[model samples]
Target chain A: MALFGSLFCRLVLGLVIAFLFLPILIVLTVSFSSSAVFAFPPPGFSLRWYASLGKADSMLQAVWLSTQIAALSTAISLVLGTLCAIAITRGMIPGAKAVATFMASPLMLPGLVLGIAFLQAARDFGLRDTYSTLLIAHVVITMPFIMRTVLASLSLFDFAMVDAARMLGRSYPAALWTVLVPNILPGFVSGGLFAFIASFDNYPVSIFLVDVRTKTLPIQLLNQVEMSPDPTVAAISALLILGTIAALIVCDRLVGLKRMASI
Target chain B: MTLARDDLAVMPAAAPARWTFDAKALIAVPGLVFMALAFAVPVLMLVGDSFVDRDGFSLAGYRKVLGDPYYIGIIGNSLQLACITTAVCLAVGYPAAWALARIRGAWQVILFALIFLPLTVSIVVKTFGLTIMMRRDGIINFLLVNLGFIERPMRLVFTEFSLYFGMVNVFLPFMILPLYSVMRMLDPRLLDASASLGAGPVHTFLRVTLPLTMPGIIAGGTLVFSISVAAYVTPGLLVGDRFMTMSQVMAKAYLNIRDFQLGASMAVIMLVISAALILASSYLVRTPGGERR
Candidate 1:
């Protein structure tokens, strides 16, 4: 009976893992298919879809826009989140625990609600720039991710090393760079990676903030799926899969995937 | 001599170098100020808008959203979708998380990647992938027919099945990650001790494992529920306009209908529901001690 129970557990685990990977594998296979229309099996294999990605003018624009926003937001969140994380971990605030929770509270809110709020806020302020609105909303979207990992890393960090370095004639900023930064580098790398991905893939918030010209990639890709059924999306998705794999490889080397996942 | 109670509570005995304020605490100010401007103020404005119209203060928006059956039905659909998705995630995610925690080495890496890789990919891509896979002539239909489960291809896309399937597929990681984290921290020796005490495996699980992991279950369940309740993309792509979720209705209100009052009320409703879930879950997670933030 125990053996059977363990077997049942293993069987369920195997099936769930397969279920998770199935759609991704299908997307990859469909991306490489020579057939234009989606089908179970392709008539032949070709790089036609990938080749067609160049002529996708708006899609490329959207990709560039998403990359910029994601990069910018991740950068901003890392600096600000790390400092706030420092304050929380060092007991520098009166309600440190509550402050940490508040910093991460944006993650608890639904994206559509945030989107609506930002929309009304923008209107009230007469802030008509789509780009600026998207960027600002994305900063909020990315901050919690950075805060979570950075706080985890900071709590495990030893600040005495910085104080020791300061005693050794190093300046405060210099001590922070030398002693503090390297110890928590893994958190920064992993947090920044996750934050970048969060901003990159955001849809609900970006949906409200985007104008026709400023549509992010997820919004644009969704529009394509609605307007036209084609492999160009598959081509883009395939490239993104490859990009994600490259990122995973980098993160695994720097911080290890297991550690990153734990955070 | 005369220490303020709030200040005393804030300062732990180990870190008692404070009376006015810790100058280092100012490091958090920029981020706090940013959140106030970007997050807090806007959400407050949304709440304010829900209670007002163009000319003056009004409850017309709430009357429309709360009174109309169509709107109420949409609210019901969102809640139902969220509940089912959260329940499914917890069910599937528990064993998966347990297995992940217990597994080792290469297979563990492989399994973890399978979950984490999809998470790294955009939800749009994942949902889009599901749509393609659920097409009449897609692999799912092909497998179903070939495996003798069905006779012919069915229109699987734009259906409730696809919506739930796509939602679970998208949000399952959020569920699994929390459970896995908690399970990793659980001591396997406790299970061994339970068995040594002559407890049956079922009894050991129920009395020992389940109680310990309740926090994880609550956290993962609430995480999935709150987020999925407000999900716009997965349902939008998988089911389109065939199903009207609160988010879809909210989107239409803002973008197409030009009804900020209606949209703000809907957003406020979502906000209140999610806030209650988050608060309840955290409250439930509190230990016999003060809390575990």
Candidate 2:
């Protein structure tokens, strides 16, 4: 009976994994097809679509814009989120738990709601600049990721080392800079990486904020798919998959995947 | 004696003054202010806008949304879809999560990575992949035809099935991760104890394991349900003009029609529903388990 039970569990796990991976595998396969159309099981294979990526100027510009917003927002959120996390974890404020929950609440809220709210707020406040509006909205989107990971890291951290540094003649600021920062560096790297990716690939929230000349990569790619329905979008998907894998590897090296998942 | 007393008073004053900086609180101010201005205020304004219009404070927006069967039906459909998607995720994810919790070592790492990979990639990319597969001449139809199941390609792209399939693919990880986290921390001794008492595996699971893991189930369910309800990209891309979710409608209200009041009202509804569901689930988890560690 136990053997049979175990076998059933294994079968379920296997099938679920296949379901999760099959679409991505199909995309990868389709990216290398020689055909211009989206036919499965292409007649032959070639890298021509990837080479043709250069002709898509808007897609390239979207990529650059997305990278800039992601990098900037991640950097901003890292510093702000880390400070807030420290305050919460160290019990320096009353109602820290409530604050922490509020900070991370965006993760649970739907991006579409946030998107419309930001649009309304931007219009109401007379914030006409699309780039700044996008950046601000993305900061809200990315802060929760940074706060969660940083808060988790800080909870595991021992602040006695900072006090020790202080007692050893360092100023309080100097102590935190020298001791606390190094210990939580893994959290920063992982948190920042997640934040960057969250902003980079964000679609729902970004779809509303983007203007005629300021489309993000996901929106741009969606537009391309709607317009062309060709291998060019497949090629972009392949590259993004590659980029995500690279980021995961770096995250694993810095902080084990187990820790990342737990957060 | 007088001199010594003055020195003691001065020392107390110096100590309080030195401790007044509150470095931590000072550090937190910037982030708190930012969230308040950017996130909290915007959402509040959205809710506030729902109750007002050009004629001043009114329920016109809410009335329009609730009174009209079209909008009412869309909300009903969104809820129904979310319910079905959550149920499917829980049914399939429970076993998979259990298996993940039981395993260890390299296989665990690889399987977890496999689940996590799609999550990290763009949802557009994943949905696009599904679009390709579900197309008339896509792999699924091609296989079905070649294998003699059908004489020709069938229309599968813009169907409810494809929408559900796309959503389930996108959200399964959310369900599995939460459940797995809880299951991993479950103590093994309780199962052993139940077995020693001659309880069958089924009985043990129903009486002990299931109750204990209810928190995980609630958490995962809430996550899946809320996300599924508010989903726009998958439904938009997959179904296109065939169906309209509240989110897609809300997007159109804001972007195309320039109806901020209607859009804000819809956005407010989604937020309130999501918040209520989360609170209800958390309450359930808390009351039954009484705060499980």
Candidate 3:
């Protein structure tokens, strides 16, 4: 009975995973097809479609812009978010609890609302269509990940070691460098990965703030998917899926998804 | 104890005269400053924009959104869609979480990995995948047609069914995670206690396990409800604007019509509804310390 039940569970779970990933697998397969239209079991496989992607300069530019934005936004968010996390987690402020809740408010707001609000705010400052507009918007969206993970790590941590280091005459910077940094590195890295991906895949804010030159990958993909149902979109999507999976695996290996979930 | 004296001797002469690095003060300064700039300011401006008009503050945009039946209908649809999706998620996810909780170790890791795989993928890409698979000539329809369940292909792609299918698939992990967490903490010896007291398996589940897991159920259900109410992508692509949720309508109001004030009003309404649900669920979560029959 146990054997049968275990097999059943495996089969059901396997089917679910396959269903989750089937379109991505199909997209990759379709990208290699000689045929222009999307179809399973292509007439013959060819690398021409993948090669043709090189000529789609707009798409190429969008991918480049997305990479830049993700990198820049991640950098900015890391600075602000790390400082913010330390302040909230280690502080003895009267309203620290309220401040923690306030920092997490972005996660609850609908994307449409957030995007519209940012667009309006940017316009008031005459900052629309600039790279800084999108970069700032991405930071707001991604900062929550950093704050949430870092706070969780801090809350679960033992402050006794830090006190001992202090009592032993270690400077604040020295203690932080030696003790806190190593302890929190995993959380920060995982959170940073999530932050980058959030910026990379973001469309709601990007669509409102992006210019023709500043489009991110998702906005570019949306444009293509809206205008033309080409298989190359699938190819790009396949690249993104592969990239995201790789990121997750690296994150798991470094910090472990189990730790992330607890946070 | 001797370390306290020895540490005082080694203390740096240039060390500041503060008792310690003020943990509270340190945490507050940066986080509070950043929150004011990035978060509070933007949302406050959003609310302010909703009330202002050509001359000054007015309720015109709010009136426009509230007075229009078409816009009002979207609120009803948003609530209905969220409720139905929450119910379906609970029904499907409860059994799966239950089954997984019964297993352990390497098998447990694999099951968890399967549940979380979808979350790693982009939401837009996932919606696109559903669009392809649920189309008229898609695999699902092809199979159903071949099996003679219907003589002709059914319109599954641009309907509520497809919307629910996409949502349930996308949000399944949210349901499973909370349920799994709660179930893991449940004491299995209680089952033996119930059985020894002459309770059948069904009775044990209803009277014991079900009540114990309500917190997880409530937590997960609230999450699904809040997300579904504000979701635009799945409905926009799959339902194609024929069935509009408040979020979708809000987006259209801003993007298509270029009515920023009206759009902000709709957004404020959506936020209020979500806040109400959160407060209610948190209240439910707190009111009961433990399970009740």
Candidate that scores best on lDDT: 2
Could you arrange the candidates by DockQ from highest to lowest? 2, 1, 3
For model 2, the DockQ equals 0.57
Estimate, for each residue in A46-159, the C-alpha lDDT of model 1 and write its tens digit.
998999999999999999999999999999898888888888888777788888888898888988999989998998899999998999999999999999999999888888
Interface RMSD of 1: 5.6
Q: TM-score winner between 2 and 3, please give it.
A: 2
Which segments of model 1 are wrong by more than 4 Å?
B1-23, B196-198, B287-293
Model number with the top TM-score: 2
Interface Cα root-mean-square deviation for all models: 5.6, 4.5, 3.7
Q: Which residue pairs in candidate 1 have backbone atoms (N, alpha carbon, C) closer than 3 angstroms, thus clashing?
A: none
**TM-score of chain A for the candidates in order shown:** 0.97, 0.97, 0.90
lDDT by residue for model 3 over B1-293, one digit each (tens)?
35455447656754432344453356456656766876678878989989998899999988988899977888899999889989988876776776677778888777777677667677777777777777676666777888988887677888888888888877777787888788888888898799899998778878888899999899889988888888877787778778988887777777789888888899899888888999999899888656643
- lDDT per prediction? 0.87, 0.88, 0.77
Q: Write the per-residue lDDT of candidate 1 for residues B60-138, one digit (tens) a residue.
A: 9999999999999999999999999999999998988888878878988888887788789878888889999999999
Return the clash pairs for model 3, or none. Answer: A87-B27, A91-B23, A91-B24, A92-B24
Pairs of colliding residues, candidate 2: none
iRMSD computed for candidate 3: 3.7
lDDT of 3 by residue, A134-186 (tens): 88888888878887888887777777777777677776566666888788888
Q: Is candidate 1 or candidate 2 better by lDDT?
A: 2
DockQ of each: 0.53, 0.57, 0.44
